[model samples]
Target chain A: MSPSDSLAATGEDQLVSLLTQNLPQSARTLHGPGDDCAVLQNHDSSSLTLFKTDCLVAGIHFTMDTDPARVGAKALNRTISDIAAMGGQPSEALVTLALPPDLPLSWPLGLYKGLRNAARRSHTGIAGGETSSLPKGAPPVISIALLGSVAPPHLVLRSTGQPSHIIAVTGRLGGSLAGHHLDFKPRLAEAQWLAAHGPPSAMMDLSDGLAKDLPRLAAASRTGWHLLPDSIRRHRRCSIHQALSDGEDYELLATFPPDLWPDLSAAWRLQFPKVPLTAIGTLTNPDIKSPPLSGGWDHFS
Target chain B: MSPSDSLAATGEDQLVSLLTQNLPQSARTLHGPGDDCAVLQNHDSSSLTLFKTDCLVAGIHFTMDTDPARVGAKALNRTISDIAAMGGQPSEALVTLALPPDLPLSWPLGLYKGLRNAARRSHTGIAGGETSSLPKGAPPVISIALLGSVAPPHLVLRSTGQPSHIIAVTGRLGGSLAGHHLDFKPRLAEAQWLAAHGPPSAMMDLSDGLAKDLPRLAAASRTGWHLLPDSIRRHRRCSIHQALSDGEDYELLATFPPDLWPDLSAAWRLQFPKVPLTAIGTLTNPDIKSPPLSGGWDHFS
Candidate 1:
């Protein structure tokens, strides 16, 4: 039964009672369950591995017509991006699918084809997955989990962005809706180069458009940012809303120092020419004069 | 928008074309987008870390009358149990939620309470999660992904049951309907203890009922099993169908050296006494002449 029925009966206190009352101190976890990925040290090396998984559903996140391969690519890329945002190299991934009974075998098989195809291209394998069929009316859903590694001391993170840093992005924006959203590759190469070199100040992927997301990096670093509209990619027919609210542009939105701009740009072409790089803004300590922007894609808002 | 609208768009080959042609070799993923859990080794580690995630929807996996906390609990446990079945320890987790619009603000909030509550008990944390609301007609859905560690030099797997090994389970079966299904603990502690100590031969969580699950395990191990009916628990009122077909009993069913029974029981007591332990059956060393069990759970069957 739903929690309300229990609430109507035993009240909320019973809720905790029904849930485990005494959890163990947790012995085997080296870093335990709250982090970008489960942190496990490589006994023989100076680095650690990072892992994560994410899910998106059709109708809930996208329509069925969304390219099956991009859906697969995005699902895989999103998790890999998590590893990248943390400044790690993604080396593996797994996908699980939940389909409605009416779902065509080919639809999910297509999703897998997309998933495996993306995996193979990345030198990733189809580790394996479970395909479950749900009752009618249930939407199509896909979930993927990925694993990657980084040298010990330099995993980049949202909490790492600091005041007085410059915020940077790789690649142009505003045109993701055309066909790029589904086929974008995660910045695994870019992240590896940055990690092996040095921290990029603070970083995150611009999945949700930058207008709203730039501030999150700012907030995570406890800083505020200034963006010149002129520096951002803008389509003639697209409004700032599209730039601010559109999701699925999996490019690296990172922060570094102004002096590092030359190095960042130089590194992008020599190492990652297939993925474009750009400078979108700068970060400063948040203050009364420049309030932080909190206007991203709030699910409810 | 489904592939259903375009007959020309269906087929595994079509999916393969969309996915394979555009994959990049730069990602360095040893395995991606398939397998029970993506297996990867960083130059840093000698062993592999397993990652996975799945979603449970209200009205689909449960009803409105279900405990919101239990719903949250089950969401995490479902995946954790999957890890347990593989004899791994879940070290980190992430969640994504899609809620119904116009529900009491307390709804999602209460669900988070349940989520954190489970995390606390499971020794996991809230980590990171995304929340969004769907226009009406969307059922409340919660998705969770977990990052886990398998001991180096050895990782227990779901597809590696052996012939002639004993199949043992901790806890009674066939009575999840008695309210035990909603809030079961993943045998994380027990499974880890087993992995470190005895090493169950073939393992997996029993979610889709023993009848259906046993064969999958047997097939994975490349063997058949003879069930000792007396070893299985059952409710007097529970039909053979319910005993074999009901889903959502988060118990550990594993096979190992028959001699390890004593040590395994002691470990179970030290780790999961709230749950029972029993030796249920043995795996045949060779293709058996007669099968002890008649059937397994099949949604289509």
Candidate 2:
């Protein structure tokens, strides 16, 4: 579709590319858009700041009747997952709420309770917040802007994968919407451990399922990829397609050099005995023909 | 009103107090909520990072027929004003957009145009952004999270005003919604100037109007205040009541020591001759009686 098409026709990815093209990027922006988080050169000489924002709307991310506390937890956790994807630790967050003025205060208070618990557990400070009234008949929305910190050596990026890299995913996937989406644990400690240990060549979070997210990581790394047949680890009662295409997994997806696999696997098993880390695929040279790929959840399509 | 009351009954300020009370505040949070921005202690001891977020909703901040570009600019500028309020220079921003899937692609592109121009002018980088499709019949929304940097000596807060301090504001107030709200320039340079020379004891932006915002500053500073008779500088064709209560003025409200007013005012004229700095009030002892103050814009009220 052309740029003149509606957003539904253009789709989220293409629309992002079109809108971000020629964006006014400052010299301080070490990495701009297209990554899990934007990396900015802060005053600290050794560390970079990770910046990301995510939003949840009533009737979209959650129903109006959904528990307000869960809604708030999911909103902040979504952004924290992005920080984890970059091997960064969340530092602070700013929350913006848009709701109907007539709504009971308990809704936001409950939302904030969820937010406070999630942030406290993650060691993220709630720095500031703003609230605005939505027009009549509009659904409520919660948007979070998070700042994270990462040492330059520990910073993982989506554009650094190479051919022969083994693609691995953390934990089981699929059927997350049953309840997991509301309370999925962001793989922050695991990602940090991976970065401090073998340090994957490239990494990102599995929010849009392996089918969609894997290809994105591949494209960003300037490589192609092929998933091993029946290699994906699916959740109980979930089909293989669901494992490959269901979104909101909030798990780590990383690529490691083949040589590091043996030791890294042993260490990962020891470090995270309860969490499963599965090798799913390998990055291939961009020039090579890629295997057929299934599409995942798309917001506008 | 009780905390259990509806948002409209509790009002914006009381609701904010309820929601943010006992929030997760990390050790790195040098200054938390109740200010224009949160001051975080960065690794660089010489400087601090400012974090703030603000949002705009269709049918509230602007109508569907309003220029899309202006909407975009306004969204980013509102957050930037918070940064300016802290005497900081904006470094980067993360934008989150929630819109209908059927929206024309040109709408977002135009919005980006406005965001790009405003960011370029302020030397702020658009770091990363996210977009989500709103459910059917949902209004469009834009939220911006901005990061800014301030040197230690230049950092300003809203809780430092003292008795007898001169309450001054930059530029004329009121009548901003007559097209000015959408395109008004944030007083970044002027604020940075004030922070550098005779840095105000307390400072904030006039978002909710002087009548409301002034008392907020006074309360935060643990002081009472009185407006000098006929001292408010109103926009052309605006009544004094409008000047006192019309919100979205987006001007700087600061308290400075009486001793520095002469030299500071003269230097300000040299630095920003086109902008007027009006002395409208004075901080007073908390025990003193305050004249009846009119309330300004309240989202819930």
Candidate 3:
């Protein structure tokens, strides 16, 4: 097959693998790709540095008509959320912006203001980044790279959960398209609490919906999961399927030992009264066969 | 005046300032924007982490016809150069790519291969990043974020040079558009050597040409510079003016104490026989006035 044909047939996952194939790993790298963030061992050894990058294209993440400040804020939040998913505290961020040459200066100014506000809220200092003009007809793109820190003991990974662990989610999911995607706060505090207390065995942010992301966590942990359809939480306007399949929820999906669920659930409610922590399923044995689950948003698909 | 109109008149630098204005600085941020990289104090006070991001747009950095591998390599190299300029060792990188949905997968595969090759050459690992599809007509964009480390003493800054220091540049300059820009090495080894030896008082990469970048180094150091037109080393095909005004040279511009030039120059030659270190100017007192120098490439202008 032609190179393009072969690449096209394999899709995004295969393409990423092809791109990263055989790349050397630094001795400092503790956890590389296939997770919410790459964790690198710091010279101190007591703390690990978390690195994550998330990009937002105008048409895909927001439209030209979307408030520029919100767009900027979302860009910062997306990466910050990833750090949160890793059960870490964000420390700094670098932003890269690509804009049309003729774009009015106010748009970028407003966008920066939004980014500054979000960074302040998250206590993530905007460090250094680059800005360049795009081709005339191209859409503006904002990409943020975040650096965070996690105490080695408190660090969580999607690959560490064991079968029979109770699967739980923080906050409600689904209906993010109704504007929650733009304004929802990342559950940084909640993740921190989970890491410190029940200390989730595996954790990730639900940017790609439960149906798709759950499978990822399962695959990474070398296990399987079964969602209790009746236990799925949804927005008033959302169906159970939408709760499972719609993305951009920015909530945390975590697994805890079944023995800790009772106390952990109580503590979560006491700590974050406004956000609900619900038990939705259990991680299954790797050998178990389950019916196929609906896939979530895939940029390539 | 309307915000847009005000921003338009102020331009990119002003926009960057306005964007960063009133942003809180974390206690961990030892250095922020306005430099090659942001230096964050690691939890272990002995080592500092360096952060930087640079973006490349299709039409602005290269044309669609440019080799895909070169595009990927350039993206990785650009950020690596920033780390090099800071006299640091790059450890990890995250790459964000935005491409048109219909783009041939082979193009991305080629781009990844190029990125992987460059990362290997620098011994910098490609950690994790995000990829998303752009609007149909939008051009592809690549942005890279690099994490590196520098010993406190070996760390260099563009704002630390003193008046009367000798200004020198590594390698040739100008006419990079002829194809040198895409393929030039990042001078990482040379920078590491300088930091370990005479150690530049201030340093930066010549991505925007001497005329423009020299002023930046001087301004950051709170000084002025006088370049001897005859002393500049340029590409054979480049004119004196082009040598000063053209950008993307990716060479190192460094300032050293006048007393150390003889020893530093001799050592540089002995260490890098193929790369010429040329003394072209001297940093002047901040109050000194010189004729207006030509500005380098400005994204907004």
* Local accuracy by lDDT, each model: 0.64, 0.90, 0.86
- Candidate 3 per-residue lDDT over residues B158-178, each given as its tens digit: 999898899999989899999
On TM-score, who's better, 1 or 2? 2
Query: List-wise, what DockQ does each model earn?
Result: 0.22, 0.76, 0.65
Order candidates by DockQ, high to low: 2, 3, 1
Report the C-alpha lDDT of model 2 over A1-301, residue by residue, as the tens digit.
6547888898888888888888888898999999999999876679988999999988878887888888889999999999999999998998999999878888998899899999988999898889999987788989999999999999999999999999999999899989998988899999999999979999999988888888889989999886784887888999888988888999999999999998999999999999998998899988663566777878887
Q: Write the per-residue lDDT of candidate 2 for residues B33-120, one digit (tens) a residue.
A: 9999999997779889898999999998998888799999999999999999999999899889998988888889989999999999
* iRMSD of prediction 3: 2.1
TM-score between candidate 2 chain A and the true chain A: 0.97
Least accurate 10 contiguous residues by lDDT in model 3 chain B: B1-10
Error in Å for residue B273 of model 3: 1.9
After superposing candidate 3 on the true structure, give the runs of residues whose Cα lies further than 4 Å from its correct spot: A6-10, A287-291, B6-10
B-chain TM-score, every candidate?
0.80, 0.97, 0.96
Q: Model 3 clash pairs?
A: none
